[model samples]
Target: MVLTPSSAPSRAPSYAAVLRTPHAACPFAAALLGRLSYGVAPLSLLLALKDATGSYSVAGVAMALFGAASVTLSPARAALIDRYGPRRVLPPMAGLYAALLTVIALATWNPGAPALLLGGLTMAAGACTPPLGPVMRALWSSLVPDRELLQRAYSLDGVAEELMYVTAPLLVGIVVTFTEPAAGVLAGAVLVFVGASALVSSPAVSRAHTARPPAGGPAGPRLHGIAALRHAVLVTAAVGLCLGALDLLVVAFTERLHQAAAVSWVLAALSAGSAVGGLAYGAVRWKSSSRVRLPVVAAALGAALLVAGVSPHLYALVAVVAVAGLFVAPALTTAYLIADESVDAARRTQAGAWVNTAFNAGSSGGTAVVGLLVDRLPIALCFGLAAAPALVCAAAVARAGARRPRTAGTGAAGRDAVSGA
Candidate 1:
């Protein structure tokens, strides 16, 4: 099913056409809900922990533990999905994760609860959160086998992700306003459970499972050996670092302006820019290879951030930040494309999960690094530091693209040729 220059259409299929395909709706809706919860849960955790302990330090520690657990455990959980299929893996994990979240929410209300107990629950909950993003992306290959259409699907998913980020925080705010911070946690838990259950039940996802090989057959290459996958993970991690720094920078900048109330709008603007960019990128039929396009886009993103570093006013900062975010979803969607093309079908979920884990790790590290620098250095200098990782990502992508052969095709044949090398 590899689509070479000869096979691909002069114009890519419309996003609407891709969406109209049979069995597309269920997985999309389910994944959307699950991803929205994924967006909400961490902030909800922070708020809940802060409310319960009455100390931001304890809350930070709990969040750190939760993030660490997710980064540590995701690959193993994804491997389980790859081998046993989502039907068997997602449901049970989702249920356990939901239960843990509820327990954590209730514990947040107990004045006498120990810090150690709360931290453990947070970590466990993170460890158990379903690998919805990876699973859904993996399903796209089977659900829409056409390379061009699949690219469109990924782009649409990326745009949906931007919407989720924009909406989730608002949802959390509303929940926290009407109820307690712990109520936000409970709401996120419910979303995860219901969304994951519906997703796993979808026929598209059910049919997309890769069966385990017979016990005696040769296993696939070690994760490190898969150059495309490794590169995708590294590039994604770098992007995550940029995102993490930007998040803190926005907060610091807004706080400095004595307009903290504008933070949400500022962040929403960035997400909106990304959504627009992703839609545009997906709609066009690009003549260039993904390898070539990836670095170019990364460099553009870095340059935008560098300009943002020197912005003189809140309006200028917002403008540059939105411009920088324009490339975020496109770059990520391309990285996912690379991972999908780089690994064996049986190992795709694992590779996707590892990429996600790397991104999360980088974000956690970036936040810690940027938080320290926000007070110590000038705001502009902090932004320049944030742009550094994006530049590194560009360099890494350029190097990887140079090493790989040029391919107009990005299907089974293209992937097989790459993997075989």
Candidate 2:
């Protein structure tokens, strides 16, 4: 049952039809729960550290270390899942991650605990975190073999992720306000364990465990051999850089207005716009190649972000950001589709992980750069600087499109290679 575009029917399926397939619910729910925790954990960790240490610097350091550890370890963890399957990989790792978080929370509760110890614990927790996002993407490919339906599934996934991004912070905020920061962290731990357990136990995931590699071939492709994957990663990283800058810019904008509480609303508007855009993009079939679409959307995103950077008032900025956000998820969805179609079946999870890594790295770099600029320059300048990455991404995508036809062969072989041949 190796699925390919050639084998799927020509007619496109509705998203409702796709979701109605047997055994869809368990995996979808589990993936969503795990994703929510993924969104919630970072802020929870930061708040917990700040509560314990009474210094934003210490909290930032701990959070940065956690992110660094995850970025470094994600590819290796995803590779393991590809080789051994989620049933064997996810449950143990999820349990270990939860236990580590529990330990970090206990340490946070101990007011005298050293900051270094807490930072180390958070890093360890991040390293062991389950590769839920990559796994879920891989599962969708298996669940829906129709090319058109899969695109819709990915769009739905993107929309759900945006919702999580909007909701998780509020959830963390509520927990922190009512209970304690450590409770928020502990809540994330509980979600991770519960979600991972359900995902691993699902029949679909269990079947994926026995999924064999390409016949008479190895379990994965050589990374250096794939041009599409390399380009996809680069494009995705650039998008991430702009997003990182936007995150900080919003904070700076709210702080300058002395309405710090408004930051969440501004960010949520962006996510909401992305959610709407993703649904629309997924619903319609595109005649152009993904490579072409990638650059066009990236350029539009850069243009919109440039406008947001210069907005004169809080209301104006929020409106611009919302408009800018319409392009964000579509760009990412394009990147994921490029990666999915570029790699061999056995390497799909690994390819997705690489995309995630690029985004995280870009976001980290963007945040650091914007953080430095915020102290020295006007916030508008910082916003303009953020737009730089999106422009670079557009250029990179255009260059990749130019090179694709030359390096890719003609007819079936070339098409297969380009489309996960």
Candidate 3:
């Protein structure tokens, strides 16, 4: 049976409803595992590379390259999901990721071409990039009958992400210190493969990918990619730009402190804050769009940036990082919700992918810009400059709010039907 939003009941699902089916739980569990494992690999690789080479710069280079690869390929990955089913794509990717980890481990053991090749392979295998985030979002959209539940789901996702950042690095550090970084990487590989494979095997995910029914009468019109891009979405995309900048600012902050070893801690602080914000936002019963949350988040982020820019002490810097992160997930959750509601259900995934793509691009671009600023100016100046994007984002949100109608489901249904086709 097709589950459309229009057919959903008015009442919220009771605790009994939540318990009656196991499907709702599957995506959340899968998300937890996938996020945890993914978090470990980067921490392990960075620590291992830096320890072996005694060069934080080299570690940065490795990370930059990995991010570059992922950013470059993310859209193509989404397109592939659009074409081939996610089920067919994720498992092999997991296996290949495991092989690459083994190669990296061997490379660390011997430090040679085989390891280098594997590292490069790992980067290129963006083709197999696990669809954990997208798939989870899809499952949430399907399983939850209420829009509020969907909002809560994304908020919970943000919280889980925060928890991963909080613990993954420490775990990676401990494992590497007691044994070896290679061991930690290997463990991450194992967890990723196991968890991702299990998620792919779940009935809900499999059905969502393959259950496209035959169309009656012209199949309507395919949603023009351009038409799918709404002004609200465009505004929220700018918030992503700020986040990208913030990610880089944190890295640059660690470098300026000459405590490059603790860069991940700064990142964790940001993630933790975001997770807290998401959880808190999710708990609230507001039905407003990004119109409501975007400004609040933007103001918080701007203030945090100001503090980070001016603070001279490391503890103060960390505090500002946490404060800055406080708004990140909330802003992002708002963006996702806006994008989801703005587009047609059929085009929902594409819209969601567009948001992800924008965020990734923003992050990479923001980091590169901040990194250059750090080289040319004071760290304070770099941190201060990061706020510019957030300010721009806030302006865009205000403009969109002014133009947008108060309710989403009015005349937009005709527009959405045209688009969703």
Candidate 4:
């Protein structure tokens, strides 16, 4: 079912068209269900630990352990998926994660759970957490070979994930209001297990598996095709670093204005702008390949952030932040698209994982680094400094992308990549 431009939708593909691809809806929904756990489980864990330990410091430490394990090991988990295929690997991982969460929930259900126990179990849970998001992105590359439709799909995914995070905390709020926060952890356990079960059942997942190389050797062929991923990961990290700084910078901006209540609105605007930008960017029919487009979008985001701190009023800052947000999803979407193009189907999950890892690691770094600078430097100047990474990284990517030659056909010739959607 390999599809060419003539067989696929027009240059500007709609999200609806992307979803309508054969056997797409069910697995995608299943992946989202699993991903919802991701949005909910962490917050629930934080709350549960806080309730159990009666100490914010203890809760923070446990949560930090969980996040670090999850982010740091994402690529390794994805490598397993890449080697064994999602259908084979995702279920076991999800099952283990759900079981660990159940144990965590029970341990915290009555409070007085030992900190040592909680920390160990949470980290173990994170380590076993299935790489659902990366798998789903790889699946998209499998189901939709047409690059245009795939772009639309990734954009749709980023927006959906954004919404999931926005709503997940509210779900936690409701659960905790009525019962123990430990109950929220139990709920997450249910969600992920059910989602993974259903996702692996999809016919589309059958197509996700590729011929694996012999074990005991490095990913021989898979590693060869992924050279282009270097630039994608680099720019993605820079974008993530900028975004991580923005969280604190926005807080500083609000504090300076003595308008703490406005912080939520500014953050909301950023999310909204990103959602809008993602959809728009996906629907556009770009002639350039993603290798070139990646750096361009990264640069746009950097430029917006560079001038955002100069805003004199809350309203102005919000507007500029919103504008900066416009580039956020597009940059991520484009980066994922680059991963899709650079890696073959067998290695696709790992490819996505690497991008995710870089972005998340950069975000952690940005938050810590920006915390140090917010006190010493002017807020505006801090904003400018934050922009430096994106600008500098984008130039590096631009140079690398320039040296690479464009593909002759649909950008999937050698990679066995996207066919249609």
Query: Which numbered prediction scores highest in lDDT against the true structure?
Result: 4
Candidate lDDT scores, in order, read 0.80, 0.80, 0.64, 0.83
Per-residue error at 284 for model 1, in Å?
1.6
The TM-score that candidate 4 achieves is: 0.91
Worst 10 residues of 4 by lDDT: 412-421
Question: Which tens-of-lDDT digit does each residue in 181-216 have in candidate 2?
Answer: 888788889999999899888999877546646622
Candidate 1 stretches with Cα past 4 Å from truth are 1-9, 210-225, 403-421
Give the C-alpha lDDT of model 2: 0.80
Per-prediction TM-score, please?
A: 0.90, 0.91, 0.79, 0.91
lDDT of 4 by residue, 1-421 (tens): 1211233454466899988999999998999998999888989999999989999999988878888999999999999888877788888899999999999999999878899999999999988888888989988987887766888899999999888887898999999999999999999999999999999999888765744334334433333235667878989999999999999999998998999889989989899889888887877766566766777778888888878889889999889888988888989988898787665556778889999999988888888899999999999899999999999998987787557665554353333223221
Clashes of each: 0, 1, 1, 5
Pairs of residues at least 3 apart in sequence or in different chains that clash in candidate 2: 416-421
Q: What lDDT is reached at residue 129 by model 1?
A: 77
Cα displacement (Å) at residue 103, model 4 = 1.2
| 1-421: candidate 1 lDDT, tens digit per residue | 1112334546568999778978987898899998888888889889989888888899998888888888899999999988888999999999999999999889985555678889999989988979999988888866776766877999998899778877888889898888888888888899999999999888777666743332223545433337666777777788888888888999999999898888777787788889988988877666555555667777788788889878888898888888888898888887777777666667778878887888888877788899999999999889889889879888977876667654454443334323322
Ranking by TM-score: 4, 2, 1, 3
Clash list (residue pairs), candidate 1: none
What is the lDDT for 35 in model 4? 90
Overall local distance difference test of candidate 3: 0.64
